[model samples]
Target chain A: MGKPPPISNRVRLHRMLAGDMTQAELGEAVGVTRHTIIAIEQGRYSPSLETAFRIARLFDVGVEDVFGWEEQP
Target chain B: MYQDLSFREKSAWAMGALALIITLFYLADVQPISWRTGEAPPVDRHFIKIAIATIVGSIIIQSVLAARNPKEAEAPADERERLALARAGNHAGFILAFGSVAALLHYLVHANGDLLFHGILISLLVSTIAESALQIFYFRRGG
Candidate 1:
């Protein structure tokens, strides 16, 4: 089981790159809930493949660019 | 509607609402009965209410499903939804089964009829709440 992190620097960076795209707007683009976008931003959860692809596509970047591994144990 | 969350999360929203309302209604009904009699009913009023409620709930659920996509309801749960539900159920089953056995053993040892009734009743209730909680968790976490 994974725990949620306090903040997702990746998502923060994504927003910065996009000129402050809100969660609902990101969710709408990715076909997910606003809650999910929030979760991603907060590191509470990760998205499925299709959604990841959608997000990456919207940001004009690869999935790896949008999501990154946390500093390891 | 928000796009592309799985159907299970949507169903969980409906089911969780039904579970909460029905559980509260059941407690409201059963509490008075238990208090007056000082005994839990041998039969499950909760189960009965859920069954009845689900009948209406299903109609409402189906209607919403139709409103969303008629074809979707006709199709079975998608792979992710099925996996989420199965995982949640599988996780919850352990507690449910343990609770039942513990209740039975308590009855065997103590032989308190009223307590047995309540123990089993509470077991069912706990299982239901756990199931709903797990669904919510799975919905929040991806499947």
Candidate 2:
């Protein structure tokens, strides 16, 4: 397995706040697969800039509110 | 397990299994003849049979999978799936290059084109299997 990306996201939390949206629903809204959403939430993948914007827009938040850079020591 | 897997992952597993079975069958059919004659067996009816089997089997397997998951099968690969596939292809390309080089060296040493042909063919088969395996790995590991 590859290392997880040095990125963090609140997609799962935001999904819940947004009427408990399911990963599939979020993925469908964002034009990605549910698996891709799962990977993003798990920190296994970093979304493209376009996807990041889409996700943030879907959640009614700025990209920075949804995603954060995890500083490595 | 099957239900948990994505369509692409399931396809990879199925194709990998098919490739493995075909490789074993090809070796079983040719190895005995090569042992008896003390030489690489010539391309013959057995090769043709294997080729036909591979083509037909691939079509059937793909059709069955698509039937089971029509929407997913019809959708184009997403970003992550594409990345995993490209990475698998990169690694498999190395294996193919190494195998081809080894086959060429063997042909130079033994002056046997037949063995060289079989060696390259085996490399292609093995690399295909490896590519599928790697794709499965990437899928499972969240790549």
Among these predictions, the greatest DockQ belongs to 2
| Deviation in Å, model 2, residue B122 alpha carbon | 0.3
RMSD of each: 5.8, 1.2
Best by lDDT: 2
What digit string (tens of lDDT, one per residue) describes model 2 on residues A1-73?
6677889999999999999999889988998888888888988888889999999998889999999998988
Residue by residue across B1-143, what tens digits does model 1's lDDT show? Answer: 65554455666667667766766776787778788987666567555775688679768985785678554455565334555678889877887788888888998998877667667666666676677678767666644
lDDT values, one for every candidate: 0.68, 0.89
lDDT of 1 at B2: 51
In candidate 2, which residue ranges exceed 4 Å CA deviation? none
Candidate 1 lDDT over residue span A1-41, tens digit each: 45664323376578778998887677666666565666667
